[model samples]
Target: MVYDTVVIGLGPAGSTVLYHLAGRGFRVVGIDMARFPRYKSCGGCISVKVGELLDFDISHLIEHTVYGATFTYRCARMMDIISDEVVGYNIMRDRFDHHLLEQARKRGAEVVEGLRVVDVVEKKGYVEVECDEGRTFKGSFLVGADGASGITGRKVFGMDRRRSAVSVTAEVPYRSEDLGMEIDGRLFIDFGSVPYGYGWIFPKERYLSVGIAGDTLKVGGRIKDFFNTLVRGHTLLKGLRIGERVGWTVPTFYGEMPLPVKGRIALVGDTGHLVDPFLGEGIYYAIKTASMASSVIGDAIESGTPDLSTYGEMLKGEIYPEFTSAERLSDLVYNHPRLWYRMIEKEPEIMYRFYDVIRGKESFGVFYRWIWSKVRSKPWKVLRRWLESRFLPA
Candidate 1:
């Protein structure tokens, strides 16, 4: 069968692209290895900006709305940063992805579930995708939104190397009556507690999603130990009962690599490494990138260009700057743990301001200038903290 565009992996990115293209009267086909409502190992938090981009009320799909967050560092300094507005939503990936895919199908997209794309080949005019079930599909344009280990990136783009981090997450069905709320969500990022990684506790309706992430290459068998420490040792969620324990890999590091776009092939979302390194959040970015790719590809098709050369340039211009800034911030945080600790300890208000920037409530320029002034004002204190952090082993 021939399609105007063949999108592999019907996750947020793929499904979003399909929704936009199909709604615009394009012949789109979306394929996924698994069926709808599949489980994905993710933090499942979406910023308020995502709701604006989707142009729909996601409040129904959201498990809970988080007004603010509590950030805890290794120096025993914790800050409860409250926001005037609802900053984010905690969602389950299974339900969220399925809902988006269904919306695409409702708009006339041909969705093929349980079809694993085993091989892809670019021909003279179109790209061919072969599934494990011996079905061959053809499309003028191809989009790869599979994930970190995307087949489209490896086979089509030839950029096979990916830097990844391991994360172990467990969602427990436990209620905290003492909290006096249906949901109390907090993001705990402990540096020295877990090497090169951080722990998190996100609350849902009647469940709590707890997890930890780090460089798996450095810590071999200690992943389980780290998870235990977060649940057992942490004061916030010490007595939570375990329900379903899930673990997965997140690609945290990305360099200035070329995108997976050739004559007729384009990559979106994780396939193109569009995730934010500092926050490990990709849902909003993936949806936005997929929307951009759909518009560009649809235009290329209608104009008879038949090529996707400009896709890379568009992505680099629109999305790469945010990812670059996030990478730099991630490096600074991971490199100087004690500076992060002291900053939270001395002036906890900065953490709330930082969270505002993160949730897009405030401009990055304002946040950066404030932090820069602090560093310039106390250079000696910052240097002393860095030196102190160097001696402390992870």
Candidate 2:
């Protein structure tokens, strides 16, 4: 049976796209290899922008809310940046993704789980997805959200697979008595901890998500070593027991992966290499870009035009520019840790702008430029920065 859209992968991007399309009264079917509430190796932090886009309140599902971050350099220098407002919520991907998938299903999208797509074929008027169960599904358009290494990307879109970054993650059980310090509900970002990469610790209710990500070609071979160094060198996690160490390849946008929309098939999330180059943040981009892809797709369906170049155009206008700036900043900041650390050492308030960047209050390029401008006129603001850092809790 042919449907309006056949979505491969039930993660945030694909599920959200299916939800939006089905809400518009389109016949959408979503398929995924994993069952509901399956494990996904992710930090599972969602920004406020993502919540607004989906019009879904994720606070109920949030395990913890962080108000600030402690940035450390190679386990030595540390800078604490605190804020009165909540930064982001720490969540579990298993629950978070299943929630979004269920929303799509409730909106009239048919969900098929526990089946893997073995092959994809683009025919005259519809696309065919052959599954492992010998079942074939057809749709006017196909969306591949099966992650960075999923077959839909290469088989359907003919995308060449390459390494962007390798993410190594571990979750440690948290006990109140085991914690030496009070859980002030702050996140942690460690720099200079890995070669061409960084480490993070996001607190959850009962566990802490700790991981590191680095450039695939440069540090992929040393990910294990980097992870080991991160855990060993971390000041707070010295005595805690860690578990469930897993590694996955994250695709970063570098122009090699083409714009996902073409013909009748479009890619979303990791399949399109939509993860941020600097921070390795994909959840926000996945939902954000999927919203755009779904809008243009609705237009395509209404006009009876199979051409999806509009979706590509919309991405170029809205999403690609931020990635360009992020890639540049990733090279500069991750490459020169000492320079960044020293700069923040002098002007600690600079980290506040980073909070704004993460919260979507400002763009990375704009924040970087703002910091550069402040650095150029350092003599004028030296007293102000000193007074603020000395008096403020951060």
Reference-based TM-score, model 1: 0.91
The lDDT leader among the candidates is 2
Off by over 4 Å in 2: 158-160, 372-394
TM-score of each: 0.91, 0.92
lDDT (Cα, tens digit) per residue for candidate 1, span 153-267: 7667765343656778987776567453334545445554566667787877766778887765755658778887767766666555766667676755367576757788888
Candidate 2 matches the true fold with a TM-score of 0.92
Report the CA-based lDDT of candidate 1 relative to the real structure.
Answer: 0.77
Give all candidates' CA lDDT scores. Answer: 0.77, 0.83
Clashing pairs in 2: none
Task: Supply candidate 1's per-residue lDDT for 140.
Answer: 88
Q: Residues 247-306, candidate 2: write the lDDT tens digits.
A: 988787876666787789888888888888888889999888788888888989999988
Model 1 weakest 10-residue run by lDDT: 179-188
